[model samples]
Target chain A: MTASSSLDGVLAPVLTPFGPDLSVDEARFIRLARTLMDQGLGLAPFGTTSEGNSLSVDEKIGLMDALAAAGLDMARMMPGTGCCALSDSVRLSAHAVTLGCGGVLMLPPFYYKNPSEDGLFAAFAETIERVGDARLRVFLYHFPQQSQVPITLSLIERLLKAYPGIVAGAKDSSGDFANMEAMCTHFPGFKVFAGTERLILSVMRAGGAGCISANANIHGAAMLDLVRRWQEPDAAKHQTALEGFRSVMEGLPLIAALKAVTARRTGEPEWRRVRPPLVQFPVEREEELMERLKGIGVLG
Target chain B: MTASSSLDGVLAPVLTPFGPDLSVDEARFIRLARTLMDQGLGLAPFGTTSEGNSLSVDEKIGLMDALAAAGLDMARMMPGTGCCALSDSVRLSAHAVTLGCGGVLMLPPFYYKNPSEDGLFAAFAETIERVGDARLRVFLYHFPQQSQVPITLSLIERLLKAYPGIVAGAKDSSGDFANMEAMCTHFPGFKVFAGTERLILSVMRAGGAGCISANANIHGAAMLDLVRRWQEPDAAKHQTALEGFRSVMEGLPLIAALKAVTARRTGEPEWRRVRPPLVQFPVEREEELMERLKGIGVLG
Candidate 1:
């Protein structure tokens, strides 16, 4: 399940489970992974929604090991391996590749502002060169809205021409359809996954691989179905439903709302405890979100 | 020395020295500290100009320990100890207090966006609570122009009221003289250090302690002279030279230019190496910067 091979399906940025004491609840995390796998979705843990940046390298590696022990197929997963430091990103990305994970979603070392494209090329090339593993396939994560650094089409061209095999594809979370269209048009065989569910149909229409969305944690099956039937007779109906769910998530601090929905569904109260600076939703926001979820038929 | 006992002075955000391999150059770094001390300047390392967020905790702690080992007076220096992670901030800041450093210049946990005032309060208060040291005197760092997170006036008041002694002053890098004046007026006794040299006179006029500027590396004596004669009839003459130097550094990457100057001055050409993603200035830019410096009489 290397990225050079195909990942022609939906993938969820899985919800991280915290136990009562707020430690990584590995078993529950594994359980969630299994649930997504059972629903025919691929896994992407340790992404932005997975609180990837907050976890130390050791914690991230431990979680991956636990997932492997749980017998989840690594080839179907694309763990996020990005950090402010190049070496940290390299360690996580290279290790994930060695573990037989499908591909690494690498975010640019993002602390600096307006890093030149040449700087970006150097960072990416150095990581690939240092990892020095032919088995590794790197998928650039282009969430410029958060990273403050974007993966431009020109950069993609430069990387592709330099090392065609090492740089496989990208995730365009810029929420710009035109940018996604450009990637899909220019890099024909490269796998382009939408960063959100809202763009699934457009991405698919433009010949993208399926979406790797955060909301997949709650509406996994529906979004998966939306991707599946987007070319079907009743495509519009499912697309509208998917868009509605995306709207709710967009309206709030998305990660918190996703955790809230997960908590409500699983009755896992500890799921609601986010790290400080990202507080749990206050009672009113939580209640409103719960009602929205129930109204959308996501929760009964 | 506790911040409350003696916190008013001009502190230089000391430049970090990098070896040819871009690893921490301890000897040069310590030498820079000694040089600043000899010239009647207090020391602060690991500010934005020092590329603190770009450093590993080990690098930060190692540098601080080296400074202490060199028998430099910690009472005259405030090493930056803030970071995106609360735990990391605590470890570095607490250790600074334990080592008897003057005070910790603490930046807000900045990776997240628009953190609530309560969250900011918790992040600050919790660090103090965890360190739980009576000797800790925190100098809040407000550099919104860089950190993308501003410390508002109300928040400052709240933190001051909560921990009267633990929170001492602030370093305002907003580059807004009006804001500095407001801060000085609001917090009567709080020592405010202008983040930029351009604002030094206005800041001093508004009762600011002094500046913690990156340009101070090149114009340390002239800037210090301005600080000294802030009330003298000929003070403006020295400040004009400082301004001319500042304009050149502003036109280039100040940190890189400063390093290049140090490298050439100390005969450590290898110190010109910057970490990846921040390559050394192109030869033309370097040449131009050198010419600019020579014209201003800082270089020959």
Candidate 2:
């Protein structure tokens, strides 16, 4: 099957757990990923919500190795393999493709802001040429808020013109539903992933693929169910519940709040430990956040 | 002597030369760096102008090794060692220290935009701790226009309070002379390096250390001269000339223009090659730019 066809549902831009020493807690990571997969969601490990940019190349490579060793089906995984360094991106993308990953989510070379379209195109072309893999499927990450580098439609057109099958699709984390809808409309077979599940129903109805979400780390089962039954008569109610839960989560720092919710579910405080440049969710607000989650029926 | 003491005067964020294959040409890089040193400037290799962020850690380490093997004095080279990944930053910083480099210029962990001050502190603190070397000196790089992650005065104060000796100084590249002046004014012993030669006189008068400049790639001897003769009667005229030169350079992509100028000066056309995400200077504009440079008395 084509990469786009295989990537047609909810996927967790998975939460990466760390030990007290801030090293990737491989066992915990594996367990959490397995649980998400069991909930019938795919994995986008090392995306922004996963604190992917905060991870060293060597650390990420080791984590991928661990995931493979655990016999997790690599075909269900589409890791975020982009970096500011072209060499690093090429290395990670090639490695991911080698491991039978469904695809790789690639951020633009983000360190330079407002780069020329020629430069941006050159960066992608350079990496693709260097990787030289026909099997590779790249999903462009357009998160202008975080990366400060907007992946414009013209650039997508240029990329698709250059590499038809290899260009694959996009993940729009910019929160511009119109842009997502435009991608779904513009590229007939393009896989368009909304960055969150809050827009999954509309996104799916737009002939978009599905969501690759931050909340999926906490609410994977519900979101996966929504993706499956999105056309059902009760789908509107389901989408509303997801939206309500997301609104409360949005009030807190995203990754931290997602981890806090996971910690609550599993009784494992260490799950709340984020790496440097990302502080832990505040203990002071934990009770209040949990109470609100319960008020919204997001918690049992 | 301390790491700070040895890092006075102008330092070129030296240009990186790429081959036809776009791999770094170590020989050309070393030759260019050696020439800059001979012109009485220190080196800030692997900096923004050098496409440091576009380079992998392995590539940087290899460049460092080549420099050492060529007998370039490590104590005169304060390479840019910071990365979005704390682990990569720590590794590069420690490596620079172990090589006996004078100081390491560091950008804050920049991937996540508007990170909490607490998180910024943790990223810096975590890297400093992991490197675990007292000899490691850090020169904070404040270029908000590029990184979009400002290194605020409050944040600097927190870092200095935590690690006084290790957090040596800063390079203010925000193009805000008032901020540079304020830094030099507030921090009694702190070394504040202006990001460009245009601010050198004012900054030096305000007790800033000399500049760490991209223009220094093409105009090292001139900037170094300005730093030495700022107290001379004719210094104001000298400063105006430098500013005029800078104005023209700013009109183009700074690094690409710098490289184009270098290519002209050295008669080595390959000097115009820039890595991806940074295209070469437009060939069509070369004559006009050169004529403008000549008009300003910056070119022969």
Global lDDT of each candidate: 0.80, 0.89
Residues B138-212 of candidate 2 have per-residue lDDT tens digits of: 899999999998998989889888998888899999889999988887777788999988899999899988999
As a TM-score, model 2 comes out at 0.98
| Listed models, DockQ each | 0.44, 0.87
Query: Could you give candidate 1's per-residue lDDT for residues A3-54 as a string of tens digits?
Result: 5554567888887776654457788889889999999899889887887765
Candidate 2 lDDT by residue in tens digits, A67-131: 89999888888899989988899999999988988899999999988899999999999889899
Task: Give candidate 2 regions above 4 Å deviation.
Answer: A1-4, B1-3
Per candidate, native contacts kept equal 0.27, 0.84
Ten contiguous residues with the weakest lDDT in model 1 chain A: A1-10
lDDT of 2 at A143: 97
